[model samples]
Target: MPTYQCFDDLQLFFKENNIHPNIRFENMNENSIFSMVKHNLGISIIPEMIIPKGLESIKVIPLELEQTRTIGLAIRTPISPAVKKFTEIAENWCRFDKNIV
Candidate 1:
């Protein structure tokens, strides 16, 4: 099994499996984390959004597990008609991007 630095479920799995990786206590926002991984300083678990470009040296193997995050829209009370229209437009935009109705 490949190692990871920051997946919550994967960390639990590691504990269950009694396999400990060289976990560095670093957050993903720091560029050093990517640098370290690229330099083979250590392997890390990063979100897909932050993966760097031209990383042929690094391999991004996909996992079988399915994961998703929920996104929400919020507005202040007494939403105006314009705001409602804008919200509809935004939803349409997102639906178009996803090719969904």
Candidate 2:
């Protein structure tokens, strides 16, 4: 897993489930984790959106626990029309099913 903020969350999940992972590798990013898993190094938990859908060498499994990451849009005050529209669209997009968000 990443040695960043996300690792804290993953650690929390592990603790909650009383899981003691014998972590053998650490990486800074998802692509490296994917590469490691692809090479049969070990399994990793990553955001579902990142898994390449067509990768036949790997299997994707859904976790029973639902996890979410916060996302944001940064715009200065006095927002332009385009920014306002984009924020509106983004808000609506997030309100939909995950498949469409």
Candidate 3:
């Protein structure tokens, strides 16, 4: 499992539901988590996008709860032209269709 903000959120979720899981690992990246799970080290809650296909040993189970993840772009000062354009495009895309959930 990760030792990030999402880890905290997952902990809160488990606590709220009274699910005392046996978490045997921590501070691992998504790929590391996948590897561990594939080797039967433990199960994990990872983002759907990061999951690779064609892994017969692993199962992709969708979470039943309604959840949303907010993503943002972080750039240092004195950004380049390409990065500025990309950010503009991303912002526009995010604002395009607010009603489509």
Find the candidate with the highest lDDT and give its number.
2
Q: Candidates sorted by lDDT, descending order?
A: 2, 3, 1
List RMSD in Å for every model shown: 6.0, 2.9, 4.1
lDDT of 1 by residue, 25-54 (tens): 655454766666678787665555456677
Q: Rate the local accuracy (lDDT) of all candidates.
A: 0.63, 0.80, 0.76
lDDT of 1 at 64: 54
Off by over 4 Å in 3: 53-57, 73-79, 88-101
Poorest lDDT segment (10 consecutive residues) of candidate 1: 1-10
Predicted structure 3, TM vs. truth: 0.64
Give the alpha carbon lDDT tens digit for every residue of 60-80 in model 2: 877787766676788899999
Candidate 3 per-residue lDDT, tens place, 1-101, comes to: 78866877787778877779887778657778878888888788866656777878898877787555667689997999999999999888777848223
Model 1: residues with Cα > 4 Å off, grouped in runs? 1-22, 77-101
Best by TM-score: 2
